[model samples]
Target: MTRILPLLLLILTALAAAQTVEQEQQPIPAEPEIAEASAEEVLDIPPGDISPLAGVDLTAPGDITVMDHPDDSGDRLIVSFSPGSEAEYADLFAAYIIYRRPAGGSDEEWTNVGVMPVGEGTQFVDGYDPDFPVNIGESYEYRVSALYLDETEVMGEPVIAQEVASGQWFHQGKVRVLVACLIFLGLIFYFFSRARMGATMYLRPIAGIEAIDEAIGRATEMGKPILYVPGLSDISDVATIASLTILGRVARKVAEYQTSLIVPNRDPIVYTVAEEAVKQAYLEAGRPDSYDPNSVFFLTQSQFAFVAGVNGIMMREKPATNFYLGMFWAESLILAETGSLSGAIQIAGTDAVTQLPFFITTCDYTLIGEELYAASAYLSREPMQMGSIKGLDSCKAILMVFITAGALMSIMDLLAGTQTLSWLKNIVTTQIVD
Candidate 1:
C-alpha cells in the first residue's frame, strides 16, 4: 500500500510539471499603441452667432400703400405692398406680417393686425380687430414686413391711408337688386291698373283651395261639427294670419249652412283673433245668432297638452271635417292621425316644412308651401289681392328666366373654357351685403 501511494504521487507531480511547461510555451498579448498628436492639430473654436437663414438674404418690402376698403360700412382699410424681387428671395419667404397703430402712436404700440402670403403683389386687410375696431374718419399708420422661415423679420417703410373709410349712401354692389326691385314695382302697378279696369286675373288652380268648400259641405251633410285648429302660433305669425283669413271664409260657409263649428286655439291671442273672425263671418252670413261663443276658445298654452285636448275633442265630439291650418310643429301628426281615426275629412295647410309630410300622409288634402299663403287670395278674389298675386307671379317668372339663363351660361363657360360671360355671372349672383 505504501508503494502504490508513492506511485500515485509521482504521477500527480509529472502532470503538474507538464502543465507548467505548456504555460511557458504560450505567448503573452502586448498593449495597443496610439499615435502622438501635434500642438497645431488640436483646435479651440470660439462661440459665435450663426444664422439659420445664412444662405439667402431677404430684402425689405417696398411701395407700401393703404386705401379704404371698398363697399364696406366704413369699418375696414386695405393695406398693400410690393415684396421686392419675389423670385430672387422666394426661398426663405414665409409670410408678410402687417402692423398697424393709431397715427402718431409710438413704435412700441404697433399691433400685428393681419398676415398675407409671400407674393409679388401682397395685400392685407387691417380692420378685423374686434377688440379695437377701426374708427370711422380716424387716421392710422400701417407697415409691412417680410417674415423669413427662420423667424427673421425685415421691416418696411410706413404708409398712411389716403382717405378714411366711410359708408356709402347706396351700395354699388347691390345695383342689380335695386333694378330688380324697380322692375317688380312697375309690374305691380301695371297689374293693379288692369285689375281696377275689372280685368279677370287668371291664377293656377290649387287643389287644396278647391277642396275647402267640399270639406265644409261634407260636415254640413253629415250633420256633425267642423273642427278647425288655427295653429299653435300666436297672431303675429304670417301663417296664423293667413289661417285666420281662411277661417273667416270657412265660418261664413258653416254659418250659411247652420253647421256646428269648433275652433281650438293654442295661443290666447290667436283664439281672440279667431273668435272675432268667426263672429264677423257669421254676421256677414246673416246668422250671427248661430255663432257659438264657446266654439272658438283657447285650449291650452302647453304644446303637448294642447295636442291632448284636441285629441280628446276629436274623440268625444266626433267631428265630420277637420281643418288644420297654421304654423304646426311636431303635434301635426298626432292631430291628423286622431282625425283620421275618427273617420273625418281632413284638410291641412302649414308653412312648417318639417310637419308637411305628416299632414300630407294623414289628411285628405294638404296645402304645401306657398299654397297656404295664396289661399286667402284664392278665396277672396278681391281686385287688389288678385293684382298682388299676379304681380308676384310675374316676378317669379322673371326670376326663373334669369336662373335658367345663368345656369346655361355657366355650363357654356365650363365647356368652352372661356370667361366671356363672367360679367353676367357676377351680376346675377351679386347680393346685398349689410
Candidate 2:
C-alpha cells in the first residue's frame, strides 16, 4: 500500500477540492474544536444545514450552514434574534452574511450580503437594501456568522441559510481545493530537497554541456580568444544563473590553458555577476592575476544590438571557441549563424524553448529548457545545487503525469459523453475551458 501511495495521492488530488475563505479563495483556516482540538476531529454538518461559507473545512468543526438561493423568489432572508439572545452573546459585535457564486465554481470570491451594524436590533435582513437591484432567477448562497471581526481568537459558527427552491448542493464537488494545493506544494519542495541531497537521479545527458571540454581545448590550441555570451536576461533569471555557472567552469579551463577570454553581457547586473564568476574561477585555479576584468564588459540591453556586438567580436577578435549561454530570444539563430561563419567551435546553453531549435541547427550544442538550469550541478557537483536539479526533474515528472492523465481522461470522456464511465473520465475543467 505504501508503494502505491503516489498513485493514491493522485486519485485523492483528483477528487479533492478546497474550503472557501471570505472574498479570496484561500483555504479556510483550520477551525478550532468547540472544546479542544484533536488531530482527527472534523467539522460536522447537520442535515439541511449550510456552511458559513462554501467548500469543505477538514480542520473546521465541519457542521456550519452555508446559504444558497436557487431562485430569487424570496428576495429577503432574516434570522430573528431576541434581546435576551443578544445579551447572552455579549462579545458578538455584528452578524455577517456571506455568499458564493454559482455551482461548480470556486468560492474564493466574496460579496458581503448584509451586516448588522453594531448596536442594531438583534434581527438582520439580507438582500433587503434598495440600492442594489434585485437579481431574479440567479442563484445565491449565503452563510450567516456572528463575529468579533477584530479579535484574533474568535469563537463559534453562528448559523447558515440556503435557497430551498432550486438550491445548489454543496457536497457535489471536491471539498478541499486549498488543502490539495498545500499537498501539491509540499510534494514539490520535498522532491526538490531530495534531489539536492544527491539522491540517486538519472537525467538524459545534454549534448551542449558534454562538448564543453572539447570546445575549450580547441580554443586553447588555436591560441585565440574564447567568446562567452551570457544570455540577455538579468541575473535574476535562472537561465542566466546557469549560464554564469557554466562560465565559472569555462573560466577555470581558460585560466589553466592561458587562453584569452571575452564575455559580453546585455545587462549591467549580469555583467557584474559574470565578472565575479570568472574572477572566482581564476582565483580557484591558482591564477588570480590571469583573470581579465576588461574581458567581461557590458554591451547595450537591446537584443539585436547585443547580437550585433557579439557578431563583431567573433569577426574581429576571431575567438576560437564561442559559448552562448543563458536565456535568449529571436537573436539566437543570428548569434549561432555568426559564430558558425566565424569558423569558431560553438557550444551554447540556454533554457529558451522557442530559441532551442535554432541552437540545435546552428550551434555544436544546446541545453534545453531546464537542462540549461542544470549545468551548475553538472559541473559544480555541489550538494544543494544538485538537489535543485533533482527537484526540477521531479516536478517535470509530476507535470508529465498530470498532462498525460488529463489528456487521456479527456479523450475517454469525449467518447463517453458523461453518460457511461463519467467518473473515470471527468477532469476539473474550468468554465472557461468548457
Candidate 3:
C-alpha cells in the first residue's frame, strides 16, 4: 500500500512538470503586435465578392473622369461619372463619397473631400481647401464610392488629373457694358477735339448762370458778403463736382469785385476741394491777397444741423447774395427760405427733381435738370467743355428723333391694325440679356 502511494505522488509531480514546460514554451504576445492586429481588423477592406448583409448593397459606382474646372482659378477639379442605369442601382446607394489622394500618396493618406446625396447629381466639383491651397503643378487621383444604408461602402476606380488655373483677359459677360462705355468715351473725345480747333459751340444762356455775375456784383455794391452752399453731398457726387466748378467762376467774380465770398461745406472732403478751387480762382483773378483761408470751411456732417448753421450765417451776416448749387435733399427748401427771408438774391441750382420746385419757388433764379450740369461748362466756357456739351446736345437731338419716330410708329400700328411698325418698335425698346 505504501509503494502505491509513492507511485501516485510521482505521477502527480510529472504531470505538474509537463504543465510548466508547456506554459514556458508558449510565447506571450507583445503589446504593439496585439494593437496592430486590432487595427487591421477595423481597417481591412472586405472581400470584393462578399454578399451584402440585410439592406447593404455591394455594388460599386462606374469609373469616374477628372478634369480641370473650366473658367475657374485652377484650384478646382471636376469629377464626372455616368449614373449607370438608375433603375438597376438607384435603390442600392444612400450617397456617393468623393475621395482624393495626392500624387505619390498612399491609401492611408486619401482624403474624403465631398459627399453627394443619391440621385442628386452625377458630377461633383472638388474645390480645394483654401488653407491647403492646391499646388499648381501637383497631380491628384480621385475615387467615388457608394455608401449603403447598412454602413458598407463600395469604391470605384481612381481617376488621375492635375490643376492649372489661368485668367482670361476679358470676361464674356461684360462685353455689352464695355461696348457702351467705349462709345460714350469716343463721343466725348470727338467733341473735345473739335473744341480745340476753335469751333464755336453755342449754349443757350441759362438765367441762373447769368444771374451769378449779377449776384456777386450786387453783393459787392451793397458792401455785403456772398454766400455759396456747395450742396450737402460729398465730392463723390456729380452735382457737387459741378457746384465746385461753378464756385471757381463765382470766386473769380467775387475777387474781381473785392467782395467777401463765404463758402460753407457739409463734407470735409468737399471743404478741402472748395478751398483749393476758391484759392485757384483768386490767383487767376490777380487777387490772391484778397482770398480768405477761412472762406471755405466744413460746417457739420449732420443734415439738419448744417441747415441751421447756414441759416444762422444768412441772418447774422446779411449776405447780399446766396448761391445754393449742388445736390440737395430736404434741407434745400429750408436754406432757400432762410435766404429769401434775409432779403438776399438767392440763385439755386440742383439735379434733384424733388428740390427743383422748392428752389424755383424760393429763389429768384433756378437751374433745373441738365441746366445744373451745364452751369460749369457755361460759366467756364472752356473750349473742350463747350464742345462736349455741344456733342451731348447733338446726341439728345438724335435721341428725340428716335423717340418721336417710335411713338408715331406704335400709334399708327395700334390705330390702323397694321404690323408695319413692330420691327421698329422692337429695335427701339427691346432688351436682351445673356
Candidate with the greatest lDDT versus the true structure:
1
- The digit string of per-residue lDDT tens for model 2 on 1-434 reads 85699799987776663322224656989988788532122234454454333342212111333333323454544444333232444553344333334433455744455566557754555556775323544444443444432321222333333332233344334444545456666765776677656587565676777788788889888889999998899988988887888899989988988889999989999999989999998999999988788989999988898888899888889999888888888998999999899898888777788888899899877777767778777877666666666666665676677667777777776887755444433433432121
- Each model's lDDT comes to 0.86, 0.68, 0.82
TM-score of 2: 0.55
Models sorted by lDDT, best on top: 1, 3, 2
The sequence of per-residue lDDT tens digits that candidate 3 reaches over residues 1-434 is 86899799999999999989888565867667444333223335354534334453445666677776654555777778765333365544568888888866899978888888877788987775664445555688878887755456778877776443343455555565576567667787898999998888878888888888888888989999999999999889999999999899899989988999899999999999999999999999999999999999999999999999999999999999999999999999999999999999999999999999999999999999888889889888899889878877876776677789999988898899988857767655766343
Top candidate by TM-score: 1
Judged by whole-model lDDT over C-alpha atoms, candidate 1 comes out at: 0.86
Q: After best superposition, candidate 3 residue 119: deviation in angstroms?
A: 22
- State the lDDT of candidate 1 residue by residue for 107-186, as single tens digits: 89898887777653587776787865788999888888887655678888887666677766777777777898999999
Give the range of the ten consecutive residues with the poorest summed lDDT in model 3.
34-43
TM-scores, all models, native as reference: 0.67, 0.55, 0.62
Score residue 355 of candidate 2 by CA lDDT. 86
Give the higher-TM-score candidate: 2 or 3: 3
Clashing pairs in 1: none
Off by over 4 Å in 3: 1-177, 416-434
- Lowest-scoring 10 consecutive residues by lDDT in candidate 1? 38-47
